[model samples]
Target: MLTDTVEIDQFIRPAEIEAILDQAAAAPDSAIEAILDKAARFEGLSHLEVANLLKMDDRHLPRLYQVARSIKEAIYGNRIVMFAPLYVSDYCVNRCAYCAYNECHSFKRRQLTQDEVRDEIVEIVSMGHKRIALEAGEDDVNCPIDYILDCLRTIYQTQADLSGEIRRVNVNIAATTVENYSKLKEVGIGTYILFQETYHQPTYERFHLAGPKRDYWYHTTAFDRAMTAGIDDVGAGVLFGLHDPLFEALAMVIHNEHLERTYGVGFHTISVPRIRPAEGVDLSAVYPNIPDDETFKKIVAVLRLAVPYTGIIISTRETAAMRKDLLDCGVTQMSACSAVGVGGYMAEKRRRETGEIDPTLTAQFAKNDERTADEIIAWLMSEGLVPSWCTACYRSGRTGDRFMALAKSGQIKNVCHPNALMTLSEYLEDYASPEVKAVGYALVDRELEKVPKSQHREQARRNVEAIRSGKTRDLYL
Candidate 1:
């Protein structure tokens, strides 16, 4: 069903790429300010407008930032979707030059056993997270498709003996066969996420020097394969620092647009992961380095206005201040307390259980935001933003294309807001610390007043009690 192999090389013309870069490099402050103001009005930015914003200099960067922030607030509102990374394996086969866990790095690698993974789920559940993005390094033999399926099975099977549970588990692994994609669909994941580190074929070829991941066609066509396998919800992203951000952003938007055209489904989430420090990895040594803060913020804002419906994810790679600031500027999803090591949660649990600390597992990368899940929720509430644990969109058959339909029509908020409030209430009743719960309760009351009807308020109130009384409730009201 996938039309004439979807390749990044084919979709992004060299001339177009040069044009975006040229525009970025030569844009003036007046031009940049005009684009920002225009984008803030929700009329959406043209390719030229985005190029101009990227070209904006530091002297006028603050104005671009203001525009990005304004556009973000207008589209996404104050809801911040929270999830955590559940690292299933750190064993990789690709010899990518930038990654810390690439095969050539010789770092100690580990894969979690099913029991160990279950324990990790318990730890995350205890901390009040309801959505998890499962992460694993690409290794067919070490971390095969079956192994991922088992991990998903264990995650869905685990229960807290309480009301709230891990509602969604998004997958982030390397590209694989169509049969494997079908297996992933059978596993019932919320989103199948894969990043095409860079869209420039030559650079992509250079970074992915070895292993199956080197097959650029297979990697780029993963969304098509997943869709063919009945996995309608897939996420696409790129490592911004690997290539020119301007080129990558345009390619990314085009990639989504292509999917929409062919499969009637686009990426459920589009992530903008920048380069960060990792063991044995040096980002500065690489060409086309990380974008500065202003550039990064502008890229995200332009993406938001371009594809307003897709959930834009920014991860723990960003510092806390940067993350908090960026949330209002276009990012709708974020990770909390991520542990990119096998049995990391078990190691923590063992330390607590035995009253003795064990050696920490070798992490794949360093996480900047070390705040626990509880602390993050408290911060969001204090900022008057609702930290959501909702997976209603995924569960209620409103994902990928269906979700986009709601989002494009400006009706997504009707579902997103109510579900966010409901999920926040569940977190408060079941897992939050007393102080955190008190703050959450107050915030819920404030948020409920903004809900259109008294009926939803009553249903939300009842659901909170149901969750407290050990009765599970569906995400929909």
Candidate 2:
């Protein structure tokens, strides 16, 4: 097991961050323009530069959004990778103020049995999803690491009624030792995702009233242990509304830079989850640093310019219109048909069938977008976007620094765009509803033409045909 050698203070110096933001807040218009001009090069911005962008005047925000959109297009093109969250357990030992699963709240706590996990997997696969983020709260007794591994094994082994299977399972569990992370890596997990909740130490301490999660240093240094354990791709994020949005944004850049400097690759994905009201948490009582719609857009745009190659994820916490608006600014990945509660998907399915909402099942937080997976996929197609379910890079060994190198050099599209079309073809043929299938297939046909290489284009067309004809599946470049 790897020893803890990383100093959290080195990476997260709150005083330095405050100083930088203070300097940025006083910058003249010419200084802001120079920073923006530098950002246009696609070579990520420094923390100071990011701070300046965050403090720019409202009138200059539109130009910032435009640049972010251009950079996103240049790097990712029109493809948006899609996935869903499968909450395995809601049992927790933490008294976090922001979550409904906090020990203080009186709810029917539950963890899925192996059989129940299999049932959930069937429902998830039926929704035409190839990737899922497995979530659980930090509870050693009720939801141990062994239980998590068992759930991963079950989900990976179980096949749906229609032959649908989960191709990638990204884990979002509590911070643990390097030994546990190594075990997770051995199980072939995709990304080790853990949201810092908030990088501000005071805010973090205030919210995490109890449990191991309250240790700010240990939680902050999780990626170091993960990387040392040979888990190459780690995802990082902060709960946006927990602190000053600008401070959190600057801290995110610093965090990414620290990882890149140490591990040779930064975050594989950055999730932007804004806080929302839950069963126990009252919005009026808590002082969440919720940015206005326009300011929120600017935050996403600045993050895009700060880390051009990294994937920025926007979850269902944002409204459909907000999600749509931010998509062009920087978001390259999103969750669809998500259920934040333990056993929520199966309960939701049962409710749909019987017209009875299950009172026992409780959500972690409320979602703003309530569309089904097929509905979201169809919407993406209508907007001229490719809703991708491709997991080729992880399975093909193009991860960590290797994936970043391909993305930075503009070569990933040659593989990713075609792979997206192939995966969407599979979704349409195997699991889409009639209306969604029609839209998805039409979108695939048009997108396949945009592939740069004629050989790849022809092969993709043939692969789609093979998938449709029941000859093959999971074909990718």
Candidate 3:
């Protein structure tokens, strides 16, 4: 089962955390420019300036957004990395007060067996998702370390003699021992994700009063442990509504800095999830800290200005209109068609109960924006954004620092956009709905017209037809 029984506690020293925050707080606007210039030249941002940017005011927000957009153009371009969350289980061992999965809640819990998990992956893969984030609750019985590893191994190894590939499998599980982190690396994870929820110590304590995750340092320094265990790419983020947005944003920058200083691998991705009304959860009484839309955009834009090279991900916790508006402003990655229950993707007759399968019995904080993956991609195309499915970073060793460099330069689009269209065409050919296909085909034709040369356009057309004709080739233009 690859289970490790060791009780490990690896944390960043409090003095180190304090030192970073102090430097960040002391940095000035000129200092921030120096940092941004260095990032442009060296392909990495200074952690301190990122934290400083979070403190920027409304007066400078517009300029900050412009710089962020320019930086995004240089690095990621208009290509939006697309993925989906495959909920494997909803059983929890933590009682964090703000979470829907808290154990104190009387909601039913459930887990997917190996076959059920494979079924879920099949559904996701059919939707042309090359990357998936595995979401699980934190109970050993419900989601054992061995089970998670097996799912990954099966995901990667199952199609050894098959046709399609599920290129990357990112995991979002609770904090665990370095030993477990090592096992996950051995199992081959793309990115190990665990949100600090909030970085304010007292608030963190109050929010997570009765769980092992309540240990602030252990949870906060998980990426350090992951990096220590040789997991090159790790993602860090926060639940924005749990604490003041400004404070959380500052803390996130500080946390990214700590990783860069200690392990030389800053967060590869930063996610921002706001609190949503959920089953058995009272949003008003529990989280009075939620930021409004304008404030949320500011937080996102500030982070972009702060960490010019890092990938920013926004999830379905936001509405369609909100996501559409924000994509070009700062976000680079997003989740579509996410369901927060085990076996939730199975067709109705085929669906199995993950804790009763009742609407009132589900684990999601709220219904997602309800756009299918196809619908989302079509929307991206309509907006002149490329829906990317390329896993070149991991495959080509451009992850971590290598990836950061290319992203900061704005040079990544040359490779990313064409490849994204290639992958999008692959999805459209296989599983797109008629409405989706109509929109996607038209978008492809339109985007092809934007290609610089007729020769490149001819090759792209051939690739698209190849993809449609079920004779897909490697997508290296």
Candidate 2, lDDT over the whole model: 0.89
What is the C-alpha local distance difference test score of candidate 1? 0.79
Best by lDDT: 2
Worst ten-residue run, lDDT, model 1?
Answer: 1-10
Off by over 4 Å in 3: 1-48, 157-165, 347-361, 409-411, 445-462
Would you list the C-alpha lDDT of every candidate in the order shown? 0.79, 0.89, 0.74
CA error at residue 139 for candidate 1, angstroms:
1.6
382-471 per-residue lDDT for model 2 (tens digits): 999999999999999999999999998999989899999988888898888998898888888898899999998899999989888878
lDDT string for model 1 (1-477, tens) is: 554354443665657767776857787666767776676666666556656655667676566556656666655678999998888888888888877778988656788888888789988888878899899988889998899999999999998746546889999988876788888887788899999888888888988889889987788888888888788888889998887887888878778767877789777889988887787787666755688886788788678766666789988888999998778667889887776677777777677799766554667677788888888889988888999878887878888667777776777776677778888888888778999999998888788777666777677767666665666755565
Clashes of 3: 2
Instruction: Say what the RMSD of model 2 is.
Output: 1.4
Point out where model 2 deviates above 4 Å: 5-9, 161-163
Model 3 pairs whose backbones collide = 74-410, 75-410
Residue-wise C-alpha lDDT for candidate 3, range 1-477, written one tens digit per residue: 212343333333445545665566666668666655554443444445655655544555666667767777766767899888888778888887766777877866777777777777777776777888889888887678898898888777544212256788999998887788899988779988888888878788888878678888777767767777778798888888887787788778767877777667688899988888876678767787899988888778777766767788989989998897677568999988877666767742244344443443465678549877778887887787878777867777778877766765555555566667777787777667888777887777877776655666677778877877877644645
Cα lDDT for residue 203, model 1? 80
| Model 2: how far residue 222 lies from native, Å | 0.4
Q: Give the lDDT of residue 400 in candidate 2.
A: 97
Superposition error at 431 for model 2 (Å):
1.9
